[model samples]
Target chain A: MTETHWAYAERMDAAGLRDLMLAYGQDVWNLAFILTRSRDLADDVSQDVFLKAYRTIGTFRGGSSIRTWLLAIARNTSLNAKRTAFMRRTILMGRVADSRSSPSAEQEALARRVSDEIWMQVLAIPYKLRETLILQAKYEMSIREIAELLGISEGTVKSRLARARRRMMDAREEVEQDA
Target chain B: MPDREPEWYRRLRGNPLQEPGFTEEQMDRIERLAGERSGASRRRTESRNVRRSSGMEREGGERSEMGRSRNETNGPAANETESATGDRVGESHGYGESRRGKWSGGMEPVAGSGDKVRTGAGDGRTGRRPRRIRLRAAAAIALASVLLALGVWRFGSGGADPAAPGPSATQTVPGGGTATTPVQTPTPQSRLGEPIAVLQLKGMLAEQLPFSAEDVTGFEIYAARSTQALTVPKERTYVLLQNLYNLDLKAAGMTGVGPDHYLGSSESATLRIQTKTKSYTLDYDLATNTYGAFGGTVFRFYADDQVWLLMQGLLNAGSIWAEYDRLSEQSRIEAETRSNADEPVSKAYSPERLQVAGSDYNGWEKQFLPLSSGIRINDSYMGTSSLIQQLGNDEPEVLRVGNAIVFATDANKTSDGVGVGLTRDEVIRKLGEPNVKTNTRWDYRIGDYLKFHLLFEDDKVRFMTLTMPF
Candidate 1:
């Protein structure tokens, strides 16, 4: 939300940059984490996004909020990272690797009981729908804001939101039927 | 009782799913990378300034013979900066610390090669210049590839494949330009009747000018829609034409009747080439050639490269054209990445949007449709005023009523849901309260680049307009 910080970021010192990292680092990380659904992927992406933002600070024209611009950059970077070897390997071998990575009884118990099935279903949704839902339902972004951030028309944003809501409702219906 | 919120939606808004914060070690590495990038950006800026100053000093020399300036050819400043920055960065990033390090070993040679260029260019010998140029070109290509790769990944496309004219015999303008005119030797096209034609021509010229503007010596394109001017050096102009057709003016069916006049023809159109000639009378004698005063021939081509010989001349147009080219590419990539779902964000105004009758904002946006027909924007650099002029069908003077943009063009398109002449209270009654409101103004978002701003006078709608896309 501190959108004006980038106005002077071009000449900002290490201290200023550190302050910025502290201020907005969590939000950026969370955005990346939501998109990737992996903390480690979020970590790499958040760093890359900040480095890119620091480098391209001069290109920010002050026409939009700095947060919007940074989020846009994060979206691009995260998508690009998706094509890299690490991400591909992670996604392809993830279920097995995730089980292998945490074989303890406590981890299994936590996954079964603590984790919310609906939230997991939300993450399980396709990226485009999931992102649209997250931005609107979580961040409370307006239709216009989502369209602007995603670089799509407002009509498209509305359609995507409708589709995402329908999918969530269907998932809920299946869960209730099973119950 | 109030309806319970969706469990998933509430959880998304709550703090239960907070991801872990970055560790100290990750922050340190991130800081170091940011520092290196920032330092590189600073060095690039400094190098550009050095090149500009050095190039400007050697104004009368034939530096462009190499198709580049002396500073670019020498390239000491950039090389020096790169090497110095690389050393600092290498030390900070712990490059070469481990064989299987995250930092690539290829960075070392790139930095070392910078030093090589600085030393080689300082020697100033012709023999090794060829090899040096080749090496520099290779390095430049490598750097360009890296940047291009970044662009492709960022935008998920090959990136804006700008349809630039090949660097060949013909000298097509960089930005788009006029169509090859109809075959009439001296009959100029009627300007007033061909407003749309002229507008389209201007759009093309703006697009093509980016590529060929380097040929122009003077540029003044934004004065009036009817008149524009361009100039190029006499010798360069001749080279451009001669090389384009690969023929001499005399051999190409042209007769030089006067010192500055040549008449030529093709199968269809007659080409009249005229130049502004000047002579200096000698006051004193030189060793064996001339007198006290010396004159260099500067060619001035007037309007009418086509049939009637009308239209403004282009000045040192290449520079401006190049800027537009760069900015356009940036916009294209940004838009592509933003709208990556196969369907490009439609710039077209939907007819359905206009059908909303009884809305207060109706006529304002419908005003843009008729204006949008013939008014094509080649570059985003143009302002709202340029588009408004074409839509209103009024002269610039008549349209210059107030600071506010006039959205009252005569079109049958239905209103955008809101109309003019509504009071602040009435507008609120119809459209609900604006997202953002001030004492005298109200703002509402129609889309990303589209917004409505209303300025009120005495609680009445004094002016209202939609924001234009860049």
Candidate 2:
């Protein structure tokens, strides 16, 4: 009998891998964007992570959900992308802000609000704390699930979230004072 | 810090940082890339197999060297590592439990002992047996290949042409192209359309008129079911009968060869009918004046009196038609009763007038009230839209605003049902002039909050909205 993808990992054809990748495309793409703080880099990281997962799917065990496993891969891929000088230079020049011209006036306004200096402060926060907050606020991932995905302890996830929230609150206060 | 999140955080919770999803184009590109990758991987596996086979041949000369190599390659440590890797891979894909039974034990020694290898060196004994076994396997595979070719040659290719079209996918749409989809097979529920009623019923007679010819020269009188004869203009009768026959052809799921020629089949028999080109079958009832297929035995208009003898072999006694006629009459009676009981309430006749319209919407029945009379109950949005049932067929139903009554009147009704498509001027003329007229809306006030609003777009009544307190 022909072996299924489940029974034979290294023997899995590209179609099987592609079907698996399609399910988590959105989650991985959004996670990459939140981490990289750049849509262009997020696109690059998402493609790279899927290709990499296709190569290393055999190494994956059932210790975590496929989504969690893919997210773990996405986290590492985003971190590696962020460290590149090209991405660093883009961030330094404040060119990472989304500027895609939206046709709808309401959507454009909302995008502008999301890209405001307040969100920039959140981005300025350390990577670990920033990802923790984004996962909580944006994805609504629980502390335990975030810990399992990030390969960190639950206590570490909770502390990171608290620190991220404090920094964002303090940054908002400072902006108000300046205004 | 407050326990609650900030407004920014709250907004972020509800709406994630929106990212553009993978487009269809990207998905297609990904699939193409995957196919290429898999093809490359298969090529690599094929090359590996070739290399391994060649290596085995070269090592066949030295027995001891081959044994040592095999031990190194297929050792217990290597087997354990493979097992762990397989387990991990299987676990990821949800097949871990089934595979746990597999590879649970340690690998067997490739050569039982060094003593066995020494014994093999004395003679070329172990080598000759493997070569003979491989030869037998090769012969079996070759024989199977020959048999397969013979089978295909005799049965597969000769029996049927792979490319020959067996059946037409659909009917030929007259004068050229084939139909993209098949014609709908007739059913009892299918609306009676020209020629064939789909079902044999007396009610079908009411739909059309038929005529008879006095000169039965070419037409032989089959078992004549109807004795009374009616005359119609020969030219008109010919065209009408021809069209009715075409309808019958379609209803029978057959294509007509020519006028009065049809080829169709029932479960038990195939029917080929050729009646006189000018003549057609008429129903027994003269009032309905309908044309139908004539059959003293089968469902066809027979041109000869042989049908009388065939009628004796008939299995059924027209009970199906009788049951249908009885049900049709029963439904007609029920519809008449409903029409009388649920007659549209006149505005002058309504005892319940709006008291304080909006404010007095207490103790309102959440059921269908007599006020919603004349308005067709739109069951699609039943109790979904704010617990108030929406009325009308396709367009939104118009009821008197702040009151339950529907204004289904000549003044209110327009070409697009009640209160729709009427001009502001036309509506005013019909409803005896509006009590209030805004720039965009004309309101006919019945009470404090109850009113009929004629919403206008470009001075034409676009639609109407009733303001009921509910």
TM-score top scorer: 1
lDDT of candidate 2 over B99-123, digit per residue (tens) = 1111111111123212122111112
Stretches > 4 Å off in candidate 1: A85-115, B1-5, B15-21, B38-470
lDDT by residue for model 2 (A1-179), tens: 12234434654466665666667777787777667665555555565556556656675555556667777667755654443322112111112222122113323443564534456666545566778887777767778888766544687678778877886787788779998
Candidate 2 regions off by >4 Å? A1-22, A86-119, A177-179, B1-5, B13-21, B38-470
lDDT of model 2, residue A40: 51
Residue B40: error of model 2 in Å? 5.6
True-vs-predicted CA distance for residue B453, candidate 1, Å: 34
- Candidate 1 lDDT over B28-63, as tens digits, reads 656665555524456544543443443321111111
| lDDT assessment of candidate 1 | 0.35
CA-based DockQ, model 1: 0.07
Candidate 1, residue A172: the lDDT equals 83
In candidate 2, clashing pairs total 8
Q: For residue B440, what is the lDDT in candidate 2?
A: 50
Model 2, chain A: how large is the TM-score? Answer: 0.69
